[model samples]
Target: MDYNEDTATDAVLASFEETTDPRLRAFLRLLVPHLHDLVFEFRPTLAEWEYAIEFLTRIGQKCDDTRQEFVLLSDVLGVSMLTETINGQQEGTESTVLGPFHMVASPQRKNGESIDLLGGARPCVIDATVLSTDGKPLVDAEVDVWQCTEDGFYDVQQPGIQPPGNGRGLFRTGEGGRFWFRTVVPSHYPIPQDGPVGELLKATGRHPYRPAHVHFIAKAEGHRALTTHLFVAGSPYIDSDAVFAVRKSLLTDFTESRDEDLARQYGVTVPFVLATPRIVIEPEEGDGSG
Candidate 1:
């Protein structure tokens, strides 16, 4: 009974062949081979294996309604973004990780409304148009937007300080395929750092910060839904996203200004930044409802 790494992994994986669940059986069979290969490549000592197991256990222990440590772990490892990219339909804008903070359901708002539940000192307006790749407007498209505050804290992060829907809005496109929302310019911020993922980041000498960006899960009746981010151009981590979710096309401009007339038109005050982003969606051939 030779108990080498390959033999041990094989023996363990062999036990799952009878798993009634197809997903469980498939995952175990695939994962076991990869795990064996990784063990052979790394050749970790007994202590290293124990430490890895403890770290994984701690990640599971850190999950709750508000916090999801395993998602954080996947994010830092680039697994989340990688999985999204691999499975994403290549027709539309590039997809990125949704992150772990979008736990709250966003409240629906009209075509032109404000998601900044927190009254802000700096004014900002986000104007966006939804269009199909064939140069046609896609009306009634649902754009679910969520982001952290200017100070880099999501409403969920500071429940007592921020309202439940502080920086989240679900906007439906108008007949002309247009949507606009009022919000404050978001700032670059770090991912949650009070858990095992943070400890891993610290140990690896990597920063846990993500670039300033607005998340969107946009869907239309017949178009492939896209989960993406409009990353603020020139943000601190635009080049070095801790999660590697930044795409060049998704980089957006936030021009600062004091346009009084424009502010009046958008129902906001002067001295605000304007963010006009047009998301180009390439609906699947059979998936665009006129």
Candidate 2:
């Protein structure tokens, strides 16, 4: 068949007929039609297409060992959160985007250990409990935690200023499924915007700020792992997250406590912020709870 506008989608899809993977073949078939429709509906000249290709290339070029502009692209487009939501827990802590800054492995830490390598005004204690959907304590759960500092910059973002693993930690739930950490309350900050994604946001007049939150990934045997955030109550941009990852259930109160005894107990000083959040883990499929 001669390649023509009428037969373009069919021709392109047929070219993938020999694909060995059934799922991939099906996806290409679905993708081609939409692509063809886009082209037909709003036809672009060759120069326009070249600029589009270059735009995509720059998105890839912006990535590196510690930076991911493509993930940022998905985040700004709302695709990351949509995909996570599609595969997310239906009955427990709702999952959010694994923001690009989780670039490196968190340093392993013991319960009640501090993750704050830098000092800030709002010293905080994250006293958390991991439990099953049935309210049973989930012991030995691997809880990987990370967040920006009080200044709104991650360790990865500030190479020399912040030490490695400054605001990151890998902890395990211990007795009563408890895991605690000491850190400063994070500040709301803008997503990295010195790349092509930034250009797009500026052209669209959108701000790139996210609300103050601590990232957490909880994993326990025989249960589905959860990726979520503990959003500080009343944080700026809570209603307008740049990545659209916020959920009301994830809002946590960063209450202040002036009790010196509580401070000494958590190994911090008085007037520290306290956040107690319960993370309920959902069981894996066919784990008898499903």
Best by lDDT: 2
lDDT of 1: 0.87
Deviation (Å) of 275 in candidate 2: 0.2
Q: What tens digits encode model 1's per-residue C-alpha lDDT throughout 13-123?
A: 877879999998899999988988898899899999999999999999999988999999899999999999897766557889999988889998886688888888887
lDDT of 2 by residue, 33-143 (tens): 998999998899999999999999999999998899999999999999999999999898889999999999999999988899977777899999999998999999999
TM-score, each model?
A: 0.92, 0.98
Q: TM-score of the candidate numbered 2?
A: 0.98
| Candidate 1, position 233, lDDT | 91
After superposition, the stretches of candidate 1 with alpha carbons farther than 4 Å from their true spots are 1-6, 19-26, 284-290
